[model samples]
Target: MSISERISALVGPASFVVAGGLSVAVAIFAAITIERRTIEDVETVLAADGIDWVLVSANGLQVFLDGTAPNEVARFRAQTGASAIIDPDRVINRLDVAAADTAAPPRFSLDLLRNGDGIQLIGLIPGPGGDEAFAIAEAIADIAGEAEVVNMIESAELAAPETWDAALAYGLRALETLPRSKVTVFADRVEVEAVGETREQRAEFIAQLQQDQPEGVEVVLDISAPRPVITPFTLRFVRDAEGGRFETCTADTAPARDRIVAAGLAAGATGVIPCTIGLGVPSPSWGEAVETALEALARLGQGTVTFSDADVTLIAAQGTAQVDFDTVVGELDADLPDVFSLQAILPEPETLASTGPARFTATFDAEDGARLRGRLPPGSIGQSVQTYASALFGADATDIATREVADLPQGWSVRVMAGLTALSELNDGQLVVEPDLLRLTGNTGDTELVSRLTRLLTEELGPGENYDLDVRYVEALDPVASQPTPEQCESRIRAIQEETKITFDPGSTEINDTAGEVLDAIAEVLPDCLHVRMEIGGHTDAQGGEGMNLNLSQRRADAVLNGLLARGVLVTNLTAQGYGESQPIASNDDEDGREQNRRIEFRLLASAEVAAAAGDIDDQPRTRGGILAQGEIADWPFEIRPLPRPINPDGE
Candidate 1:
C-alpha cells in the first residue's frame, strides 16, 4: 500500500473521533445549564409565594423540595407553587410537616374585695413574668387612695385565654369604683356584689357598669342598698294652714306601711309620701292608731297629730273651735288601742313678737360636723339635751351652745331631741325649731334621707304638727356616679384592639366568627363612648385595584358599624370611613404587613366642625340600610339602577 493512502485513512478516523467528543461535551454543558435555570426559577417562585421553608434544588429534569413545612397544607402549597414554575411530573416534595402543638393554655381567674379595710386581690395570671400582676397592684394603689393591696396573685408561664386580659381589667375597674364590693373575674365573665347607699345609687352603678363592659365578657352585678332602722317607730300627720304633711312615718310591715300611707294620702297629704318600714314598731296596731289619728286630724280641719311608739298625741291648731277639738279628741282617745296612750291639747293662741316664737337652731355639715345653738327647757332638760345630741351626732362631731328657758313649750324637750335626730341624717344642713314649727334644710348623698328624717321627727313631735323640708341630692358625693369617662372608654377599646384584632374573612368584608368576642367587648363600651364622636376606619393592603380596595374598606367599616348596632350600641356618635390603600401601617409586600394593613380601627374623631373643616369625614348615610346602599354601586359586579316611581295621570 502507498504511504499517502495510509495517512489519509488515519486522519479521517481521528477527525471523526474528535467531532464525537466535542458533541458529547456540548450535550453535557447544555444539561447543566438547564438544571441550574430550573432550580433558580423554582426557588424564586417559592420565595414569592412565602414558601421559603421548602428549599428547592434540581437533578437533571427533576426538582426536589426538601425542608420542614408548617403543616400538610403548607407542604402541598409549596409543591404546587414550585410546579407552577416548572412541570409537576419533574418535582419531588421531600418536605415533612411540623408536629401539632399539644400544650394547653392556662386558666385565668381573679378575686377582688373592697371594704372599709381596703382592697384584696387573689388570682392566677398567664404571662412570661410577673409584670401583669405588678401592673394590677399599681393600678389598685392609684385608684384606692394608696389602699393596701394583698396581692396573692400567681403568674404562670403559659398561653392565656382570649378574653383573660379584658375580664381582669373590668374586675379591677369595678373594685376601684365600688367602695364595698366583692368582684369575681374569670376569663369570660365578671361577677360584682356591691353595697350602695341608696336605691338610685344602685341603679346608677348598674348603668355605669353595663356601659363600660368589655366585649364578650359577661357582667353580673348584684347591688344592694342599706335600710335604715327606725328607733321609735314614729308617725305624724298635721292639717294646719299649709295643708297636711307627714313629718315622719314608719311601719313594721308592707301592709302596715300601705295603710299608714293611705291614711296620709286621704288626709290631703300631697304627692308620694314615703313611709319607712323598719325593724322597730311600738305595737301591731301601730298602723291602726296612726290611721285613726290622721282621720281625726282631717275631720278636725286644723291640727297636728303625732305617734311615737305606743304614745299618740293630738294638738288642736290655734283658732280651732273648742267644742270641735273636744269631740275629735274624745273619739280618738276612746278608739285608741290599749297599747296606745293619748295626749290631747288645745293650745291657747298667743300673740308673738318678731323673734320667731322662741326659735332654736341646729346645723350639721360634712366639713364642720354638727353644731347646736338652741333653747332647752329648765332643770336637767338642758344637760339631757346636750348628752342626747352628743350621742346621736357623735361626740367628736357635736358642739352644743344652749340657754335654759323656764317656759319653752308643752313638749319642748321632745321637740329639741327630735330636731337633733333629724339634723344628724343630713350630710350638710340646718334644723330650725319653734314651739309649733320644725324645719330642715340641707343636701345629702342619700336619696331617701328626707323620708327617714320625716319618720323620726313625726313620731317625736306628734301627728298634728307642722314641719318643712328642703333637701337636694349631690351626684359627686354619690358612689354610683363613679363611672368610666369617654376618654377612659376609648383607651380601653384601643387596648383591646392591641391584644387581639377584629378580624374578617380572607379577602372579604364579612367579620370572622372568631371576632365575636371582640365585637361584643366593643359593643358594651360604645354606650358610654356614645357621647364621644368616633370613627370606624377600614383599611386594606395594596393587593387590588385602588378603587376596589377603597370600596372593600368602606363596606368593611359599614359592617363593623352594623355589628355594633346589632349589639344595641347607639350609632349617633359613630361614623364609618374607608382609607383603602391610602393608609398603610406596614409594607404591603409581605403577608404579615398586608395583614396589619387590613384592619378595623377605632379612632376618636375631632369635633364635628373640625372633621368637617378638614374634609376627613365623608358624606354618607349613618343608617344601616343607607350605608349598605352607599356601597352597592361599588360592591356589585353589575350596574345598579333605581326603580322609577309611577306617575299619576293628572300630576296630582
Candidate 2:
C-alpha cells in the first residue's frame, strides 16, 4: 500500500499529461500504417486464401480478427495472416468446431450356471439404461450370494428389447427348479442342462423348465438320473465286553438294509446308519440273505459275518459250544439259498499261544456236554488246567484227556487254561498246538463265541500267532463227514461193485449200462476220500495173447476212471492199471475161474495227512475184500464191485 500510494502521487498528473500526448501521436501513426497496410495486403490476403469467414480491423497498435472461421485451422490461418500484415502480438483469433454425429455398435449375451453351492453368470448384455445393468447384477448377487456370482456380461450400446426383462425373469425362475443346472439365454431361446436324483425328479425339473420358457421362445433341455455303484457290498459286526459294534455296513436295497440295521440295534450295536442303495446287488434276495445272516450272527452273541455278493464268511467267538456252532452252521447252510457260500472259522487256544517254541492242546464236546482230552504243563499249571476244565464242563462231564508235559514256553499255563475255557464253549472239537501253530476245528452256529475268542486271542496272543481253523458253523457238521466216512464212501462203492458186477462189451473198452451205474457208487466216495487215493486195477483171462490181454485190461481200467469222472467224482487221487493175466485170482483153465480172474479191483492209497487221520491203514497195503491183496482192507469208507463177464465180441 505504501509503495503504490507513493508512486501514484509521484506520477498522477504528469503521467496523465504524457499519456494523452503519446496516445495522440500513436493513433496518428497507426491510422497512417493501417491505411497503408490495409490498402496493400488485408483485402488481397483474404481473396488469395479464400478465407471469407474472417474479418480484420485495426485500432491504433492492436488488431481484431472477427467473423466465424470454417474450423479451428481456418481461424488459426486468419490470425497468422493478420499478424503478418501488422504486429504479431496484437492479433487475436476466435473459432468453434461442429459436434460429432455417430455412436458405437451393439453387443448382447448372458449365461448362468447354478448348483448346490450357488450360481454363476457370464457373457454380454445391453447396458441397462440409467444403471439398470448394475441394479440387475446387484439383485442377482443378493439372490445367489455375492461370493458365487461371476458377472462377465458386457453391455451393448443398443437398447435392450422390450421382452429382455421378461426372458431373464423366466430363465431365473426355471433355474430355481433345477439346483444342478446350466442355463443359457439368447434373445428368443433358452438352453438348459440339469441333473436329478431320480427319474421323477428329473421329469419334474424338465417339465418346469419347459413351461417357464418365454413366449415365442425355443427351449432346449438335457436332464439325467443314475443310481450309485457299491464296489463290494460289505458288512461286519461284533460283540465283546464293550457290547456290539459294526466295522462296516452296506446293502443293495432299502428293506434288507433296514432289517440288518434293526438287528444290530436289537443286539445293541452302536453307530448304525442306513446302507447305501444301489443296482449292483448280486440278487434280489441279497438283502434278505444279509439280514438273516445278521440275525443268526446276533443269536450267537459274538461273531462277524462278511458278505461280498453271495460269498459269506462267518467267524464265531472262541469257546462257543460245539453243539450250538454245528447247529448254526448246519442250519445256515441248509437255510441259505443256493446262491450263497458259507465259510466259518472257530479259533481257540492257539489263538493265544506264546510266540516262542511251545506245545498245547485242548478238547471240548458240546454234545457230550464236557471238555475232554488235552495236554498241559506239569504241577500247578496242569492242575489249574484240569480245575478250569472241570469248572467249565462240570466235573462229571470233564473227562480230561490230558497228560503233563515239560519245557513249555512262558505263559504256557495261562494259554492252556484259556484254551480249555475256549474249548468248553464249543459243542465238540479238539485243538492241538506245537512249536509251529495251533488249530481249532468243531461245529457251532454260535457267532458270539468266535468273535469273543478271536478278540481275546488277538489281544493276548499277539498278531503273529497262527490258526488252522477247521470249525464249521452250520446246522450239522458235514453231511458227508457225518453219515459214513467209512461205509458210504469207499466201502459202499465196493459193495455195489460186488453185489452187481460192472460188465463190459467183449474185447471193447466200453462199460455196460449196468456197469456204469455201479461205478457211479464208487464216484460218490471219491470226494470224501480227499484224504486218500484209490486205484482201479483191471484183470483179463488167459483167452488172448498176453499183449492183447494186457491192453484190454488197461483199456477197461481207463474206462472205469473215465466213468467215475463223468459221474462227478473228483478223481484227482485215482489211477488205473492193468495186471492182465499175470495176477490171476482164479484158475485160467475153467470158464468160471477165468471169469473170476478177469475182474476189476479197488485198492486204497493214503497221503500223508490222510495216513495220519486213517490210523493203521496208512502202514498197511490193502485190497478190496474177496480180491487179491497183500493185506485186508481196513473198514474204510470206499465200496466197489467186480465187473461181470462181458458178452463175446461176436454178440453171444
Which one wins on lDDT? 1
For 415-517, candidate 1 gives per-residue lDDT tens digits of 8788878778777889888866788898877766766676666656655566667677687665435445555766889888988898888777776776778
TM-score of every model versus the real structure? 0.40, 0.26
C-alpha lDDT values of all predictions: 0.73, 0.63
Per-residue lDDT of candidate 2, residues 364-439 (tens digit): 6665765445456889868877887788878887676677778766666665565555566667888776554556
Report residue 137 deviation for candidate 1 (angstroms): 26
Error of 2 at 652 (Å): 99
User: Candidate 1 local accuracy as lDDT?
Assistant: 0.73
Which segments of candidate 2 are over 4 A away from where they belong? 1-179, 182-228, 272-274, 351-652
Q: What's the true lDDT of residue 416 in model 2?
A: 59
> Which residue runs does candidate 1 get wrong by more than 4 Å?
1-229, 352-357, 362-421, 424-428, 435-438, 455-652
